[model samples]
Target: MLRWLTRSLHRKLTFVLVIATMVPVILLGMVSYHTASTITEEKAKLTGVNTLRQVNAIIETMVLDVENMSVFLIGQQEVQSYLTRERSGASEYLRMIGFLTNLAFSKPYISDIRIIPFNGNAELTNTTILQSTLFQQVDTDPQFWKNNTKWWSPPLTTVTSSGIKQTVSLVRPIRDMNTFKTIGMLSIGIDTAVIAQRLRDAAVDGAVMLVQDAQGRTIAASSTSITPSFVKIVTDKMTNSHETERLNSVGEGEDNQVVITAPVPIVPWDAYLAIPHHTFSAQNRYVLQLTAIAVVLAVVIMACAVGYFVRQVTKPLIRLARHLPAVSLERAYRPLPVESEDEIGTLISSYNLLNENIRQLTEQVKQNEAAKIEADLQALQAQIQPHFLYNTLSSVQWMAWMSSNDQIANMVGALGDFLRFSLNRGMQMCTVQQELEHIRNYLYIQSIRYPDRFTVETYFPDELMGNQMLKLLLQPLVENSIIHGLLKTKADQRGLLTIEAETPEPGWIRLRVCDNGVGMTEMELHALRERLAHYRFDDKAALHAPVGQDTSGCSAQMKPLGGYGLYNVQKRLLLHYGERAQLHVDSKQGAGTVITLYLMSNWTESQLNAS
Candidate 1:
């Protein structure tokens, strides 16, 4: 009876359709609601932490400004001279007081500026007059000035001419510049309300912010609504931990709140942002409830409609699946009957067309395999061309010697040597030694062609001789310097070319080709760079595009800005070495030009071959 029930496509589909429609509604809705709640809580906590850090940064800036001001005041000639003077005249005392008053007026949030002498004396300040004995207690305190240190005192109340003010002040000991003795003490008072108001402004509706000292005393708080219990938990966690930043939870379950803590920059203090976890979840609860209700209603409404349509659809597919295996290369398929003009019927027509095209596709695959083999053979032939060129040059050298034309024979011999080194076993890469030799031969032939044209100096370490680089890389650059840059200059001018190599950094090699020649203008260099930007090395069409002049013969006279050799070298350096490789051309008109190539020496030959 079970097999019979399942045998009918409609019966099987009705069971499947009911489970598919109801299971996701029941499972996914619950999972989505839980995931969303978790993410919302995390986002809220993250926002609190970021805001706390921002507030810390602002407070740190203000503290640093006060400290810097103290340093500046101690260096002032008037303050230093007045403090060191054993007995100050009335004119001198008035000058020092005037300077202090100007300083207090210029600074924001400053309640007073006072110079407290270490000796028993009296001095006027920005505020009321103070006797030296009043500050003598602070001067004698070892904790306040240990190792000639500067520090911030905790918030305290002081009576000033303005009113009874609560402030935190930065204290610095004034010392004699020549004797280096503790002369006096300087205090700059900053209003605590300024910091309190900043913290309050940083905290919005969802969070409470606090700025507290190292002793866990609250320096400033955003609101009085913050519970003492929450403050104690944060203080305990901060006092026991050395972390610069951290996030923690307070209380349990629904009563829990997330507390984020960060250090105030350059101050021995911490900044805290405490927010209830439910603050983020409260906004998401109604959404989750609505979603759950909608999911339940959707499942109930779709049950009957899904069962009926799935039964209609599965019967045709059931027939189609049973005959698919029989449709193969060695046999024929029983054609699916088109019983209706719906999507199922259209599917059957498409299947028939696919079956008919299988034979043609097999033949096309065979032809593609043949074409790939032919392309590989052509690539081998191309690799062989370099060897063929080497042999031909050697033959021409001996022929010129047989004719006894000394200059012609020397040129051909040099050209042969250049090609032999360039071939370098058809690997397209060679050691630095072989590369330098190749350039020497090319320059030799050029020297014969243009006598006393340019003097070449090569400086490379003996240790880097074995390092490998692209074959014939430097020859083209040198040729460019001689032909384009040096040739344009006056004959009387010294045409100098210097090829040097060194390790710029670990695992990196740099080569420089510098010439004291008529260098390119800014426009020329910009145009050359634009050409390089558009040239795609991997695209065969772009590489073979009409780059000016063949770089094969070293004597080729390429336009300074339009040389294909420089572009070819640039493209190959980027393609083979990846983006870490760099090529730069620096030139100034009438100054000189320097071409720099940066390459990683850690790469191996097999890696280049693979690329």
Candidate 2:
């Protein structure tokens, strides 16, 4: 009877110990799996949110930079000076070009900077070295000027003059400051690879980065297979939900995975993160294994009267389960008071330390953000200096006129007109008539300074009088003749400058500028043709040399003009008219030089007959 009672007591104790050990292991496993899964999912969501925010901030900064650049250009006294003197000296025009080139170099992202006068000429007034290599593209593309909107385009393959290929362009139309007309477009090429690298850097582990167009075509991607179907899926997910959600999908070996989609929010684009189900499921696997081991141990330990040991292990786990809600809610989690110094106590202490580290990291992130803002402000200030110089030049021109030196007065007057036209007062387009008048003013002033050195005669058919041309078209060529061709001739040689516009056929107006002065050598002619063919501006050193070096004679009275003026004229014309208008230059040593411009006749049958 005594032996049976002891056996019954032992059996009861064994069952109770087994239940105590197994129950906590089962419960802790569920609780631990839930806690870890929740933390990981929350972290991924936070990462997606933070990434979207950063992309937004980057795009905003870029937009602000573009706007600031536009405003700086519009407010530039040099643009006004260039436009004001559009009818005057090549020197004034060159000055404007120099200013523009400097601005282009200051920004690495700015592929090119140009001032297209409303004249019917394609000339490059000012350009970066890289832009000088791509003049042909600007000169041949009429859509560049006709398009009125500001936007970025997909990667466009284009060959440089030297025959190198590049991609993607950002274009913004520059308007006439006074009339608000679209005069020319400013194009900047983005290094797509660099942008891709930036996106890659922003991506978190398991995250996919993508850039898409409005049509949902992926233009660029990082660490993701960017297919049309994938873009469509991402686009649909982003459109359907404002809050990001994790979707279940089959993974390798039939395992489950979670897909989290987020909108990039810079342009219309989407990003995704995938977390495999195994990551979450693994957390519970260890607990199940421990429960099996604990069951067997409980049976043996209970037989030895070790029920108190089972309770000691299970109690700590129960306390840990109670503390989970606090940790999840970001509240302080204090472990329950423990009398025993064991591994379980060490885990609680480590968790508290981790929470403290996260808090410190968050504070540091806030401080770094403040520093970025200050750096951006400094960049803005650096961009404003050139505009100030332009304004000062204007005041100086006015003072020169008041001094009663007509030569200086005329030069200053021409300078003012050229600046004004270059400035465009913000307009994008102007009539050919306006452009011609501007050029006439420029020539008149040059003729004043070198009355005996150059003569200009214009022959235009009455029918083509109303035709429109881009602004500042003729000024550069006229300036070029004076500075490069005519000025180079000996005084004994007659510097004859002739301009004629006639319609041999009903639909065409051919304008010509023929000069009887020093002609170009093969090398010089090749360089000239290459420059015009490529639409490149001359080097600043070349543009600023003594008049004789760029031209024909060493005279103290020779005007100081930059070579970029002619380049600007050619670029503006080609951008507006396409192949319908072109520049042609013919020169023979000691014989003379002639430049003929071909354009479409802006005349109706009635108008032609009436004239």
Candidate 3:
């Protein structure tokens, strides 16, 4: 086979192409089969767990009703007197039996009620005329009491006038309400048929609902498939197992099933909802079969397409080998058709990429010139203010030293530091700590300028100092908050401004400036956020962006975002960081405003130049 393919390039290439297509399709089918099986089983397990929880809740509600009734009976005056009285005669217990009868008739699920006296008196079922015994089978765990009532018993068989019935009994030690002493014990029998009704709703497709007591005895079940033998198999496999609320498979002869088990809330019993694995996977099987058919069809279609494509690809090579194709810069640079993923195809792709790079580099050159013009204008305007501030602060520092005033001296030193950081015209960006220190110096000056009018809070992480962002963004936002937000508050109210730096997610830094002062109305906020969303890397707008006046040219009614406002910061962000930068503003009238910036971490000078 290798020699026949090597005799000609066409056969070898066709063989290679066919093998590549066939191998991936076969491998993908295998992976899809395994993945689909795993996903189907997981979905089945989740469904089973939810169904069991619903069934357990219903059973808990029934048990709670029984416990509530026992609480009322334990506190009854007549029943408390019968258990604690000095009189031991038969007539004294006669009226106590009447109270038990009235309690049993109230709830329809209650089959019978028993009051077992601890002093060895006959247990009263209905009246003193008949007696019963139940405690000899159960030693009450006092630690499990619901106030005066003890925890319920497992299901038990009882014969009444109607027939033999399964009943789950609730036992309570009657207490004297005043002394809180155990007077006597009472037992309430609940029919298990009501439990079967609750289980019916939990039945999944081809599912059986079987409940077992704490001792792994099947007490209540509601399916025809459940026999004594099957119940034992499920209980044996599931009872000692430590799995909680998850479906596990049980193999029993010809029957294979998956079950989800949940403990009944009030009683120490487990409820099992077993569904056949076959029934759960029936739809999954249909999908797998359909996938097999699709894979076969895909393989057939791939062969036909590859046959015609390779022929066309070979003809192009045969024609090109005779003489090179003519090339000229005047011809439009549209992409040549991709015939096949081969050696020739890679050559074509590289050629296309080179053309794309050339086109992009030319466009980038134009954008760079526009940005340089903008930067020079900004630097010219920026140089004037910082030198003026620095010179004034130097004079104040000398005056404060002569007067021996430490507060005025500290304010002058902060102003000097702020000016020193702000006057870096050679660098367009700075580390996060540099920007934070700049803001702190500015805020300190503002605090000294308006001492009792407002307060400032700042949070900057030390670890984030290594990350870099555009300089002047944070200070401008902080100044806007102080002027438009904080200082505009009512006379009686104090103002607060919070500035924070944190990482909202990995590889992303978030800068937030918040104020608790007069905020923007809805209309103003909407117009501002809409304005920010429309800004892209607009070369013309950024180049001609007026430094001394607001030339944003969008709306006269809206605030001009030329020099320094919330929207101006966003335009700067888009100019340098491209789509990796985002600015969002939220405000409500009379409440406050919050400005948030999301930027990629560790931004570099190359990114600004490219943008």
C-alpha lDDT of all candidate models, in order: 0.76, 0.58, 0.76
Clash-forming residue pairs, model 3? none
RMSD versus native structure for model 2: 46.0
Best prediction by TM-score: 1
Positional deviation of residue 341's Cα in model 3 after best superposition, in angstroms: 38
**Sorted by TM-score, highest first, which candidate order results?**
1, 3, 2
Report the CA-based lDDT of candidate 3 relative to the real structure: 0.76
lDDT of 1 at 267: 70
Question: How close is every model to the real structure, measured as TM-score?
Answer: 0.42, 0.36, 0.39
How large is the C-alpha RMSD of every model relative to the true structure?
A: 21.7, 46.0, 21.2
- Clash pairs for candidate 1: none
**lDDT score at residue 424, model 2, on the 0-100 scale:** 76
Give the Å shift of residue 312 in candidate 1. Answer: 22
Model 2 global lDDT (CA atoms, 0 to 1): 0.58
- Candidate 2 — which residues are off by over 4 angstroms? 1-20, 74-77, 80-101, 112-118, 121-149, 155-169, 224-230, 240-611
lDDT by residue (tens digit), candidate 3, 432-487: 98998899899889988877778888888888998988888998888888888888
lDDT of 1 by residue, 376-457 (tens): 9999989878768777877887888899887888898888787677656667778888888888989899888888778999
